[model samples]
Target chain A: MRAGERAYQALRADIVEWRLLPGQVLGEVELSERLGISRTPVREALSRLTADGLTEPHSGRGVVVATISAEDVRSLYEFRDSLDCRAAELAARRGDPEVFRALAGELLEALEGLTSDDDPDHASYYELVQRMDAAIDEAAANPFLRQAQTGVRLHLARVRKLSKSDPRRLASAAVEHQRIAQAIADGDPALAIATTRVHLSNALQHALNTKELAPVRPAAS
Target chain B: MRAGERAYQALRADIVEWRLLPGQVLGEVELSERLGISRTPVREALSRLTADGLTEPHSGRGVVVATISAEDVRSLYEFRDSLDCRAAELAARRGDPEVFRALAGELLEALEGLTSDDDPDHASYYELVQRMDAAIDEAAANPFLRQAQTGVRLHLARVRKLSKSDPRRLASAAVEHQRIAQAIADGDPALAIATTRVHLSNALQHALNTKELAPVRPAAS
Candidate 1:
């Protein structure tokens, strides 16, 4: 892989995983040396990161990792209320019902082992949710909306990784997911939007409950 | 100031204004010569334009200015319906009434002479709409939404520049704008969203009316 691409992936993962916390300074020279890369590649990585909102220009030199406060998350949910609802509505209006019907069935099946402490089923559960998101986007069939959602989801990923999910929320969220998928499967645009709004409201509450949350399940899992 | 930045702006303007037509190849070497810059800067400019959705990778080599068919405009407006409604609603709920109330008055005042063939009042009318947009963004206070909307608006700008405007449509649109401004000024979120939807529906019709549009007014104007 090219040095710049490799540097970007590594740094992005680090920032998302919170190995590099908010407000941490990233010096180009130091990162280049530590990552066994040259300054040019490191510079490229930093620029990409800055564009992604993971870092911002510092007063002295280099950049500091950007902060995402609780308030930011609140605003994000408010924004998501706008975006996610429309996506759901469009999916119901245009999507293949059988696809969502199958997803709803899988969501119900996944509910059984969700409360286990080891969380063995969490990965597949999260994967299932991602599949639902993909299906909705495909059904919506609006490239402009897809592009906009991509930007929002990146920051949501960071917030999700930081959030600590309890089994209770996960179980509740599964039922919400089932309802949302079913509504889409029924081709009920209004119901699809309504269910989506309920899910997001609950998700926001769970996200805010964590004060330095212990990472476990991903958002909406 | 930089060669790459300058080339990007020049190319972007050309593409948006339709001087660089869709399907026209943008060769790095050719653009470099035309813009009086080196290959590296031309490459950088192309990459930025691709990122901006103004251009796309060609089959053989280089890139072509991306196409926005009438169909693309339809999809774009569908996407805008989701985004703009939320923004207007947020503004009505959270924004100070005085700002939007003042804008409503200006919109009403500007209704006269809107049908003039010279279109002398266009620039200021459009500027006022822009100010209303800015006020909504501030009142909404969601950076994520702002970022997403910015991406959508770039493509919308291209579509807007391409479409020909008739005096009848422009006059009707002015009254619609006045109503939208009044709704927001009233601090009624539902009414704000409803008014926004009506305006977008009309705007979409105006945008798609031109088979081979003669440039006259901006999108909303």
Candidate 2:
């Protein structure tokens, strides 16, 4: 990979996975030293991060990693509640029942595997959830709403990654996804909305209670 | 922040609010003199404003405030629907029944006063709506949603201000607000969502069809 691209990916991963925390100053000098890259590449990386909204300009201090505050999580989920519920409702109205029916089945099977197996790999489960999201977005069919979903989901991924991986959440989310998929497949917008809201509230609580957020933002980092 | 950013924010707000009209020249020396700052900071401010889409570079001159067109209105309203509907639904679910019920009552009474009187003062009616907004924000209890509202409403206020005032919207909005407040007061989230959606769409149509939006964003003003 190009030096800039390599630096950008490393910095982005560090930030996303919480090794590089919110409000941590991304000084070009320190980053170049730490990443073993030149300042030009580091600058490029920082610029990319800023564009991603993962970092922001600090007064005279250069750029600092953008925060996903407790309030931000709550606010994001609140926004997600709006976006996801509408998507689910539209899915119920216009989605292919078979597509959602299949997702519902996969979600149930994923839940069983998630709860019973010792395997910690959740990639498949998460992928299944993404598929369901894609299905819902496709069903929603409104270009405007779809565009909003894309933006919301991007923020959500960043926020969600800050959480300590709890196996418990994966199991609960499996059940929630199953219910939402089933509701959509059943062509029940109200039910889909109810299920989606329940999931969002639970997710918000999970995000708020995440160990990473418990201390709130780091004071001196 | 720095003098540059402060200048940028002030200039941006003035443009957004139309205090600085589109096509208005933003000469660095003039702004610096007005803001009691140096030209460098003013230049920095103008450059940042250009990047932010709040202003644009003029040939052989400095930046000027950006213009709004029909496309801008459409885009803003589309985004608003997603936000407002979610806020209304959340208010219905979490708001105190008495508060929204009282808002509903006030709206009805305001409608009577508004239509019955020859008086043109809409301050009372607008204040009532703002009170409802505050009540809804409080009930929703999501700081994130509330914050989003603050920004979006700023944009909305700016957009609405540019419009030629029509008396018809007030009477129509009163009925809509009453329905929405009553729905929330009755703890009917779906009804609140439906009513909020209806209001946004109607508002969008009114904004689009209004002649003010067409000729207001003048070229070479």
Candidate 3:
């Protein structure tokens, strides 16, 4: 990639990973210095971030990362419930079972890998979500739906960053994903949609309830 | 509003209302002169538009107005279906019938106010939709749902602008809104959501079929 494109991608990844927390100001000069690029490229990258709703222009605050409040988290879930559930429903109706099976296998493996005791698994979990997302996107057959999903996924990333280390949540999510995949493979759109909703509702509640890093699964699991 | 804000709002209105066609290149100097503002303010306004996904920066082509395609419209409807249906479901779970009843009465009155001979009732129709949207937003209690709705509404504005001239479509929409209001007022969220989905699907299809003016529905309604 070109220097500008590389800088943009790196910045975007940081934002998505929540390494750049909400309400953090981004200075073009500073970013350019850090990325060893020019201000023009940094400015371009910031502009793209603004379009993605990850950053906003503040007259006094310069360009600050968009913050997510508890209310915002709730709001994100409400929309996620809508978009994700719809994707699940469509996946069941029009998707191939082979896709569901493949996604499920990948998701299960990712969950297993994250169940390790040594390092933090946020990056791996995020990647697993991308793979699952790719599966859903392929099944959805709608570009607009994919765009909406992308927006939702960004917000969920914020929630995930906030609710990191919660092993119970990850375990539950894996089981719920299994349910969703099975339903989709069985061509039960209603069931798949409903299962996805349940999963999101649980995740939202967990995000509201916890803040520190917790395990990917609980003692019981 | 300040000159810059005024220019921004005016240009946005024109774009959303379909007065400005897609893929139209906007010159900063020309717009500033037309709006009787300095180029600085126009540039700021364009930056804001770029952030809003209404414009894009082309490396060699200068900044051009973003265009919507048939695929964009289809994806938009799919997103809308997921969201509106979920909102309806939530409304069924949380909304008070008395609130929707009053809103339904107002919607009916507004629909009746449109004169059959008035071919350019697009502006009026847009106004009515805003009021209807207030009702929907109220019924769908999820904040995330509202935000998703906003994003979807922006895209739908282009679709509506493409199809707004069809009085038959408008009339059909009027009937659909009534049904939706009734469904919500009757405390049946599923029915309310389902009816709303039908309305959105039909409207999207109509937009895809027509060419002259893209029907721009009111942002909320």
Using DockQ, give the best candidate's number.
Answer: 1
Cα lDDT computed for each candidate against the true fold? 0.84, 0.80, 0.74
Per-residue alpha-carbon lDDT of candidate 1 for residues A38-139, written as tens digits (9 for 90 to 100): 987787788778767788899758898878888888888888888899999999999999999999999988888686546654988899999999999999
In model 1, the runs with Cα more than 4 Å from the true position are A39-41, A116-118, A213-221, B39-41, B116-118, B213-221
Off by over 4 Å in 2: A1-10, A32-75, A96-102, A105-119, A142-155, A162-172, A201-212, A215-221, B1-79, B89-139, B150-164, B178-198, B208-221
Sorted by TM-score, highest first, which candidate order results?
1, 3, 2
Candidate 1 is graded, for docking, as medium
Give the chain A TM-score for each candidate.
0.90, 0.83, 0.83
Tell me the native contact fraction for each prediction: 0.82, 0.50, 0.91
Fill in the DockQ of model 3.
0.56
User: Model 3, B85: alpha-carbon shift in Å?
Assistant: 2.4
What is the DockQ for all candidates, taken in turn?
0.65, 0.27, 0.56
Clash pairs (backbone) in predicted model 1: none
Leading candidate by TM-score: 1
Least lDDT summed over 10 consecutive residues: which range in candidate 1 chain B? B212-221
Residue pair clashes in candidate 2: none
- Assess the local accuracy of residue B92 in candidate 3 as a C-alpha lDDT between 0 and 100: 61
Judged by DockQ relative to the true structure, which candidate is superior, 1 or 2?
A: 1
